[model samples]
Target: MGLFPTSPPRIIAQHLQLDLSIRNYRTPAALSTQKYADLRNEHTFPPFAALPEELDPDLSYYEMSGFREFKHSRHWCFLAEISKVEWLARLRLVVRDKQGALVPVAFYTDDKGEEFKYRARKGSTVMILYPDQHFFLGGTTGIRLEKESFCKIVTAPLNELMALSDRVGRYSTWQAGGRTCHGCDEKKVVDLQKCAGCGMFWYCDKTCQTTGWQSKGHKRDCKLIRENGLRAMFLTDRDRFEHFIDFLLPEPVTASESTAAAVEKLSALSIGTESGGSRAAEQTAVIVKTPYKIQPIASKGKGMVASTWIPRGTRILSEPPLFRVPRDNPDISAVDDIVVSKVSQLSAEQQRVFFDLTNIHGTEHSTAMGIARTNVLPLGSDSRSGGLFPIASRINHSCRHNAQNTWNDNIGRLTIHALRDIKWGEEITICYLPTVGSYRERQNRLRATFKFTCTCELCSLPCVYSRWESDMRLRKLQKLDAQIPGLLWGDRVEEKTALGLVRSMLDLFREEGIQDASIARAYNDAYQLALTCEDECRAKVFAQRAWEARCVAEGADSPTAVKMKKAVDQREHVKVPELDEDAFEKWLWMEGES
Candidate 1:
C-alpha cells in the first residue's frame, strides 16, 4: 500500500525531517499538452523515467535517470525556520500547488550539503539565496510572485546556509553512472590512480598514466583544475559541491572591498581616456559605458541588460580590484549573524555598496551582506566569492540568454557584450545555474540552490521533448571528450573535418537557442585545428571568439583568459607549419561545414 491508498504513490504530503521544499506554489499552465510535448520533443532525448536515486536524501547519487518522466509542474517553497542559526542541520521547502496540493522537499540530515541546478530554461527566475520574503510565490508562473502569496512558508537566514559551509558542495550531492577512464576506457574493473599534487586525474596503468601526465595535458591542467577548485567540483558528488560553489567559496576579494576604495580607485584611473585625460574625461567614459551595458539573455538566473542602448560587440564595462583574498583563506571566526549585523553601523551608501558585492550570506544578516549576495558573478579562478558589478546586477534571468560578460586581466576590469541583440525593457539574463544535462536535472538544481521550481517554457514541457535535448547534449559531450586526449598530445585535426564537427555543435546550439559554455571549448578546438593547418587568419578568428567566451565564463582577469588572449594575438601576427591532414582529423574533430 502507498501513502495515497486510492491514487499513485506520492511523496510524504507534509514536512519530512529536514527536507527541502518548493517555495513558489502558483505555477501557471498555458500551453496545451500536445504543444508542450512538441517543444519537449524538439529538444530533449531519453524520456524522463525514475533514474536510480534521482533525488536521494544522501548528498550523493543525484543523476537523473533517462527512464523517469515528469508528470506535472513541481511546486517548491521555502519552509519556516526549525533551529538556531549556526547548528541548524535540515532544510525543508514547502511544496504546495496554487490549488493547495502539498509536496514536501526535504534535505533531511545533520550532514550539511549544497545543491546546484544543471539546466534551467530562459525566463526562469531564481530567488537570491537568502531572499527577503517579498519574492516568494507558490505556483510556477512567468510573473514574479508576491511574498504574501506564499503559504506555509519556511526559511532560515542566509547566514545559516553559509555557516554550514563544509556540508554544502556545488554538484556534490548528485551521482551519475560511472564514467569510462579516458586513458583506458575501463569500467568498474579499472583501478583509480590519483594525480600527484593536484590529485584530480586518474590513470589505469603506468603506460596510460605516463601518456596522461606527459603527453596528455593533464600535467598542466591538474594544477590549474585544483587551483580553480574545479577538480574537486567535477570529481565529487555534484550535490555537495553545488552548495560549495553556490555558497561556501570565500567571498571574492573585490566583493569585500570598501566603497571608498572603489570610488577612490575609479577616480584615480584614466580609463577610456588618453594618459592625461581629466576626471571629466573619465566621467564621460562612464557615460559611454552606460550605452554598452552587456545584456544577459540566454539562461535562467543571472539576467543583465544595458541601462541604455548598447551597440553590437561593444566593450561595455571594466572592473577594478575591490579586494583580494588568497585561496585557502579563513572566514573571520564570529557568529555570522552577529558579524553580518555589524553592517548596520555603516553609512547608508557604504552599506549599499557593501551589499552590492558578491556574498552567499542571505537576509537576516547585515543588510550589506544580503545585497552583495544578490548580485555577484563568478570570477572563475578566484576561489573566494564571485565579484559584483553594480550595472550588471540589474539584468534578469532567462534560460536563453543574449549577453556575455568577462573579467579582463590585462585592463583589470570586467567587460560585457551582447551575445545576441536586445531591445529596451527586455530583461537581460545569464544562466545563474549551469546550463547542461536534462530538464529534470536542471529543475532539481534550481530548487535546491535558488529555492524556486522553474516553470519556464523549457522546463514545463513533456518528458519526450526534454529527452531530445538531453540526448543532443550527451552527444556533444561525448564527441568533445573524444577529442581531448589527442589534441592535448599536440596532435591536430584537418580543417575540413574540424569545421564539420564544430559546425554541428554550433548548429545544435542555434537550434536550441542556448549559449552553451561548450561552444567556447569548441571554438578553442577549432582554433587548434586552424593552427595545425597553418591557417593564420582562421586560427586568429577562432581564438578571438574562444578568448571572449572564455572571458565571460571565467574571469577575463583569470590566467586562462590571459593565456588565450596571447594565443589569439599570436595567431593574428605569426605563421606556422601545417600538420598532416590525416593526423589532424584524427586528433581534432575538424569536420568542415557540409
Candidate 2:
C-alpha cells in the first residue's frame, strides 16, 4: 500500500495513464510464472510489488535492492526517505527505502545541489524519476540524479502519505443519486458543508462535522492532507512529465492583503527600536566622508588608495560587516556549512560582491569559505569573533603602514584613521601581522599566511646596513615589551629606573618611525608608571601625550582616547617654571628630580 490503493475508481484511472505497448509487465506475485522466469534470473528481484494499475498502467515501482543492473536509456521512479546529507565535493544523499535498504543519491546538475539544498532534509520523501545506477570508485554502487526537473520532494514521511491515500480512496467518491454524509451515513440531495481543511467528507451540520472530525480520526488525517495536498499526487498525470514540480505541489493559493499586514506587524515587533537597536541599525545611520577608493595596483591586486590629502587623525572610513564567522568553532566542515548558509541570505548583488574578493586557498576550500578566510578581520583585539567588511577588506597589508584600522565598540563599526598624513594617490595600508618582527620573520609569515612576498618600505631597505639597523631596533622593542611588565611591579627596582625603561621604549618607537597604536600604548604605560610614583605633574603630561597619540591612531571617539581624555581633565593643575621644547622633554621625564 503506497500512495495508491489496490483498486482505484474509474475517475482516477482516467487521469493516470501510461504507455503499455513497450513490454509485458508482471506483478510481484506472478514472478514465478513460466513466462518471466528468465527475467527474474537475469536481474535482481524487486523487494516491493508493482504499483497498482490505476497509478502506473505499465511501469513497476523498484526499490534499492532491485537496482543491481545498469540499463541504458531506461526510465523508472522510486520512493525513499532521506536519511543523511553530505555537502562535500558534491551533494550526496543517503536514502532508505521502505524495506530499510540504504543507498546513496548523488546530484550532478549544473548548480550541483545548491538549487535542491532547501528540500534535502532528513525524513523527507523523495520521488526521483528516471534515475540511473552509477558505479562509484572503489567498487561502490549508487544512484545519480542528472536533471534538476526530474525529482520532487514532499514534506512528509512515506507511511503518513500511504495512510492518507487509503483514507482518500474510501471517503472521496461520487455517488449516482446523491452525496453521503460521513458522520451520519445518510444520502442527501440538498447542499452540504465540506471540511475546509481537506475539502472532502461532506457534513450536514456543525454537530456532524465535529463528530467526523473527532470521532473518525479525520483530525490527524485532515492535517496531513491539507499540509501536503496529497490528493494531487494520486490523481495527477505525472507520467506525461510536462514540466518540473517543486514543493507545496499544486501550488498553494496566493496570500491576501491581510497576510502582508500581519507580516509587517511581526517585523515591527521583532526588530522595533524599543527592543534596542542592532549593528545593522547602527550601520545604517553612519555617514562618513570616504577619502579612499579601491583600484588596481601595479604588482598587487585591487587595493585602496587615498583620493584626497588626508591629514592625521582624520576618519577615513567606517563600515559594518557583510557577514561574520564564530571564532570558537574549529570544525572546518561545520564552519563551511555555516558560511554557505550565511552567504545564501545575501542579495544577488551582495553575493556577487562577496565572491568577487580574493581566495588564496584556491580549490582546497569551497568558494565562500576560501573568500572568508582570506579577508575576515577580528572584531576587536580580544573579541571571540571576526567579520568581513566590503570596504575594509580591500586595504592591503604593509609592514610600515600609513593608516590604522580599529574596531570601535561605541559605534559598533570598524574605523580607519590615518596614523600619519596620507598624500593624494598614496595607497592606504594596515599591518596584518599581530606584532612587528624582523624583516626575515615578517616576510616568512606574510608568504606563508597570505601567499605573497612582502615588498613594503621597511622590508625593502635598499641596503644591508639600513635593514640591519631596523632589525636591531625591532629586537630591542620586543625585549622591552617582555621586560616592562615585570619591572612595573617589581620589588627591587626603583620607580625612577622603571620610568627610564619606559622612556627608552618611546625613543625606540620614534627611531623606528612607528606612529601607530603602539605609540599610544607606550605613552599610556608611561602615564601608569608616573601615577604609581605619585608624581602628579609628570602623570598629567604623559596622559595628555597618550590622548593625542590615541586620537591620531584611532579616531577621537575611540574608547581608549575617551578614557585618556578624562584622565587628563580630572588631574589637579600644578604650577611649574616655563620651559622650551628641549627642556619640557627633560622635565616630563623627571630629569632634575632624581
Candidate 3:
C-alpha cells in the first residue's frame, strides 16, 4: 500500500514542535501554541458547539451503544465542539449507513498533514471513567455525527470537573495532545484565563483574542465542550469514566511498557526458578529461552499469516516451566492427598514461599497446591504426580504435533526439538487427545473434551490421510503382539532387522500423526539397535531423543528418563567390546538384508 493517500492519513506527524508562524497570526485554519498549551495544561477538551434551549437536569448525553451485543459494537467517538480560536483541532463527522450503523463519514482538519498536532487548549477534554466496560466501534456506517454538527451542549464548572476526577483518585489533570508534543519546548501565546466558561481553549489580547472568540472559532468549540463534558459524566460519575478516556487515548507502549509486560509474564510463571518475586532476574533468561527462530503458522487467533519452509532436525524451542511438581502416584483417587501431603515436605521457609503462590486456575491456596492441582502435566509412569510447568501450558495441543517435548530431570528443564522440518504458517499443535480413532471420533473428543475443534493438518486431511490414521492403532497393536514373545524370550534380534522394523514404525507414525507411548518404544528400540552395533555416535543421539520423549510423556523425575539418561551417558564413555560381534547375527537376522 502507498503511504499518505489522498484520504485521511493514519500516520501522525513525527515532530511536535509548534509551528512558530502560528504565534503571531490568529487564523481559523491554523492553531496557535498558546491555546493548545493551555488546553493541555488544564486537562480540558475543545468545546461542544450545539446547545439545547431547555436543559434536562436528569439526562446526560454520553451513552455506550450496543452494550449487550458487544460483537456488533464499533469505536467510541467522544463528540464535542471545535472552536474558532483553536487553529489545529480537527474533527471527523461520523454517520450511519443505509442500515443505520455508525461510521466515520468525514474528518475535520486544520492542516494538510496526515496527523493532527495541538497544544491542548483547542482540543476537547472529557474523561471516560469505565473504559473497560465500553468499546467504541466507529466505521463508515452506524450512529453518525457530522462535521461541526451542532449537538445539545451541557456545561460543568471547573470545580465540578476536578471533583469528578478526584472521585476516581485522579490528582494530576488529564489532557489530549499530539503524540509528538511531549517534552516540547514551545511557549504558549494565549492566556488560559479567557476560556474558563467552557474549561477548554485560550486567547491572547482582543486583536488575536477576538479572532478566536468570533472569527477564529472558539465560539463554536465552547458549545461542543459543554455537551461533551455532560456526556462524559452522564449516568455514570466522572470517576468511572476515566478508564474509558484512558483507553481512547492510551499512553504509548514504550521500552518500559515492554519491560513491564515481560515482568508480568515472569512473575506468573511457575517453573524452574526457585525465587518467587525474581521478575527482574528472570527477564533476560526467560526471553533467551524462546527459540531464536519462530515460524508462523495459519494461526486462527490474532494476526495475519505468511509461510516459510523447514529443514529436518532443527532445534525448535527449549523451555523451562515456571513451576514443577513431581508426582509419584498416577491414580486420581490419591491426587488430592498427594497435593496436600507434598506441601508439608518443603522446608519451613520454602513452605512460606510455596503457600504464597497463585494457581493458574485462579483458586485461593498456597502456590504449590494451586500449581499441583491446576497445571500438572501428566507423565505416564509409576510415579504419577502431574508435574506443573507454566510455560508449557501456553502451548496448545493438536493431534499432529510437529515438535517433541521432554523433561530433563538432571537439568530440571523441558526441551523441545522438531522431529522433521515444519513449514512456516503451519499452526504448531500438540496432540491433546489421548489416542486417535476415526475422523468423527477424533473431532468429537477434541470438541467435547478439549473444547476446541481439531483443525490440525491430520484432522483436515483427505480420505487417504484419514484411512491411514484410522488403521494406525491396529497396525501398532499387531506389531506389539508379535514383538512381545521375542522380548519375553530375551532373543537377541539381529541388529539390522530390529533397526529396520523400528525405523519403519517411526516413519509410519510420523505420516499418520501418531504421537503416543508407541513412539517412545520405537525410539528406545532404535537406541538399543545402535548400541548392539557399537555405533556410539548414533546411539548417543537416539538415546537422548528417546529419553526426552519418555520424560515428557512420563515425567522427568520419573524413573524412565533418569534411567535412560544414565544408560546413554555411561555408554558414551565405555568402550563396547568386539567379542563375538557376529554372534547375534545368527539369532534374529534372517538370511538376507544387512
lDDT over C-alpha atoms for residue 204 of model 3 = 38
TM-score of each: 0.39, 0.51, 0.34
Candidate 3 C-alpha RMSD relative to the actual structure: 25.5
What are the per-residue Cα lDDT tens digits for candidate 3 across 256-278? Answer: 34655634533333222223332
Instruction: Give the Å shift of residue 514 in candidate 2.
Output: 0.8
As a whole number from 0 to 100, the lDDT of residue 557 in candidate 1 is 51
Q: Model 2 residue 230 lDDT? A: 52
lDDT for each residue of candidate 1 in 59-140, tens digit (9 for 90 to 100): 1122222233111112222222222111111233333222223323332111221231111112211221111111111222
Backbone clashes in model 2, listed as residue pairs:
none
Any idea how many clashes model 1 has? 142
Worst 10-residue lDDT window for candidate 1 reads 1-10
RMSD of each: 30.1, 27.1, 25.5
The numbered model that scores best in TM-score is 2
lDDT for each residue of candidate 2 in 512-542, tens digit (9 for 90 to 100)? 9888999888888888887777778777877
